[model samples]
Target: MELQKTILKDCFILKPNVFKDERGLFYETYNQNVFEKTTGLKVDFVQDNQSVSSKGTLRGLHFQNGEMAQAKLVRVVRGSVMDVVIDIRKNSETFGKSFSIVLDDVEHLQLFVPRGFAHGFITLSQQSIFSYKCDNYYDKASESGIIYNDATLGLDWHLPEEEFIISEKDLELPTFEEAVS
Candidate 1:
């Protein structure tokens, strides 16, 4: 496994060395030693979550506060998606900045988002099956989110506006300025 750092501190893109043959293919999706060696952080994933979304569906810009903050290992297993992560840590230099990548079954790549960021994705295929491992469990009281289309963040989702779809909860999420103030 090879871990490449993103613009945001501690965020990473992990590419597994896949071996293919006439029969099939094999790869180590997660190896603790390599993960720790590359990122220099020990994460013990406690929960696994999976979701399926149709093309144009957007799910987040979500995170938790305090002890419920989570670090996520995210990947798309069935189709493709435009995965995004935003730096929300008030104390960090990159606060309010965002990073994005296209994750698909063909690449089999995974994204590691540290605890202090907001995470989300938009499906780009007919249907996308997304899975992730989280270092912390879900805590409703600690849950928070930023609006996906917040002007200040200025994320280019690369999807047609007419096709974009978001839930009422997501649409009601606070903006970066709203959250800070």
Candidate 2:
């Protein structure tokens, strides 16, 4: 596997070395020793989660605050998605900045999203299975997020507005400025 750094601080894109034969294909998704060696950060992912969504389904721009903040290792298990993250660390130079990438099963790419960021994704295929490992357990009171269409952030979903299928809860999230305040 190879680690590629993103513009955001402490974030990375991991490209697995896939071996394909006439029979099938294989690759190591995660190895603690190799991860520690490549990224120089030893993280213990305590929870694993997966979600299945259809095309145009958008989730997130979400995160946990304070001590409940989580660092996520996210990837597409089946199909594809346009994954996005925003750095919200007040002290970091990249704070409030966003980064996006197309993650698909074919590429077998994984994104390491550090704590102090908000994350979300839009399914780009007919059906998508999104999987992730979180370093921290979830706390309802600590949950927070920014609205996906906040004018300040100016995020381009790359799909027509009418095509989006967002939950009422997510549509009611605070704006980028409100979230960090």
Candidate 3:
């Protein structure tokens, strides 16, 4: 696997080795040992989640609090998406900063989002199968989110605000300033 570090603290873009032939193609989606050695972080993903999003769908800027925070291994399986992450670790140098990447079926790249970061994604294709492995299980009481278009955060998701399809819950999320405060 080829791992590329992002500007955000502890985030990574992983390009797994793919072997192709006349028949089809093959790749190791996850190898615990290689992942641990390459990223130098030991994680045990207990829950695997998958979501199918249509074009223009926006989901996220979400994370769990305290011990419930999830470390995710994320990627696209069937189409494409503009995946995003925000550094919410209060004492970290990159706090309140963000990272974005285009993860698609063609390139087969995966992103590693450590605990303490908020994550979200918007589909850039007709439809996308977004999959992720989370180190922790669901925790509703600790769940929270930042508004996707928080003015202070100033993230450009490459989509017009009017064109996005967001959930009412997401619409009710706190702004960047409120979240960080």
The prediction achieving the highest TM-score against the true structure is 2
- Estimate the TM-score of every prediction: 0.96, 0.98, 0.98
Task: List, residue by residue over 1-181, the lDDT tens digit for candidate 2.
Answer: 8999899999899998899999989998889898899889999999999999999999999999999999999999999999999999999999999999999999999999999999999998999999999999999999999999988788988778899999999999999999999
lDDT of 3 by residue, 23-136 (tens): 989999999999999888899999999999999899998999998999999999999999999999999999999999999999999999999999999998999999999999
- Model 1 lDDT, residue 62, Cα: 93
Best by lDDT: 2
Which stretches in model 2 have alpha-carbon errors above 4 Å? none
- Give per-residue lDDT, candidate 2, residue 170: 98
Better of 2 and 3 by lDDT: 2
Which prediction has more favorable TM-score, 2 or 3?
A: 2
Total clashing pairs for each candidate: 0, 0, 0
User: Looking at candidate 2, what is the lDDT of residue 74?
Assistant: 97
Report lDDT (CA) for all predictions: 0.91, 0.95, 0.93
The residue-by-residue lDDT of candidate 1 on 54-96, one tens digit each, is: 9999999899999999999999889999999998888998887
Q: Model 3 — TM-score against the truth?
A: 0.98
